[model samples]
Target: MQQTIEALRVALNKKRWHEARYALSRARALTNALPADVAVQEREQLSALRRMYAARNTPTAKKAQQAKSKAVGRAGGKKPAAKKSTAKSAAQTPKPAPVRDLGDRFINRANLGYGPTNEAKGSRTR
Candidate 1:
């Protein structure tokens, strides 16, 4: 808590370094047990408080965020764009078999001009 830190700060100011140190250590240990969002907000608030204490401009905080964004961008932004080789491919080589044309006759060796046989469904006479 701020009150505890303030009390510690007061103890330090009054030439009580050991007590202040102990209090600070206690505060530091307690910090880790804080909720995740609380830790983030605490970090964000610390920066804001530092800026405020320094009597800086409100726009300075915005600029700091922009600078952070710019830093992150610089880390990944300048990947050399990949270049595709635009040279055209040569025409495909012709097949070994003769290509079929409109006037060419198709020879189906598998079918061999054979068709399905029709079977009669009548009793055979002796």
Candidate 2:
């Protein structure tokens, strides 16, 4: 119960959607303490908490907004970028970072050898 509440609260603070939901689910599972009307309140509280946490991390958010602006600028779309401020951008969804695949190399030793001697070199019976 206490563990569930704490986990849920942390998730709420982090803007982690699943965590907040899990917390609410676990809280209900543990105690079912909330009134039907209070569920909406709980969600709003979580949203405010996430907003506050994001505001505190605005510098990082600003850097990302600037980078996105640069990308748009390079693309040179006729649809000019809106001059909306940083606060608005921060409230928007965070963009997924571009992924660079360095290669899918692996040392798969499981199917390397097959003979009795190979098995012997691998593991011994107790």
Candidate 3:
């Protein structure tokens, strides 16, 4: 019974009207098996679910959802063109300095994997 109520709440929160209605019906069917006091509480919850289901299926709600979808271009409505901003330009900034390669220096110091030696392979004289 608790699980049924929880499932109904989850379905309602997710706006799954059919699933919520199904769960509500299940709750109603089990209410007869419960004690009178608990059954009354379950009946109140079922009534609230019924109200929510009706509200979500109302004509006004449907129209509002349709208008929202149309505004968002999901209902075949024409979307407004995006405006371009030209305040920032690439030519306004200065170019950065190029990077220098120092891998050859390490290679020369390591003497081509033969370990450190006195063999000067690079521009060590300069």
lDDT (Cα, tens digit) per residue for candidate 3, span 69-98: 777644556676787666566446867899
Cand. 2 TM to true fold: 0.27
Q: Flag clash pairs in model 1.
A: none
Residue pairs clashing in model 2 are none
Ranking according to TM-score, highest score first: 3, 1, 2
lDDT of 2 by residue, 1-45 (tens): 456656877776576877676666666664456565656755565
lDDT of 1: 0.55
For candidate 1, write residues 19-113 as lDDT tens digits: 76676666566566676567675545444433343433357756986798777645555887797655533355655897668664544433555
Positional deviation of 113 in candidate 1, in angstroms?
Answer: 99
Better of 1 and 3 by TM-score: 3
**Which of the two, 1 or 3, has more lDDT?**
3
Residue pairs clashing, model 3: none
| lDDT: worst 10-residue window of model 2 | 117-126
True-vs-predicted CA distance for residue 76, candidate 3, Å = 31
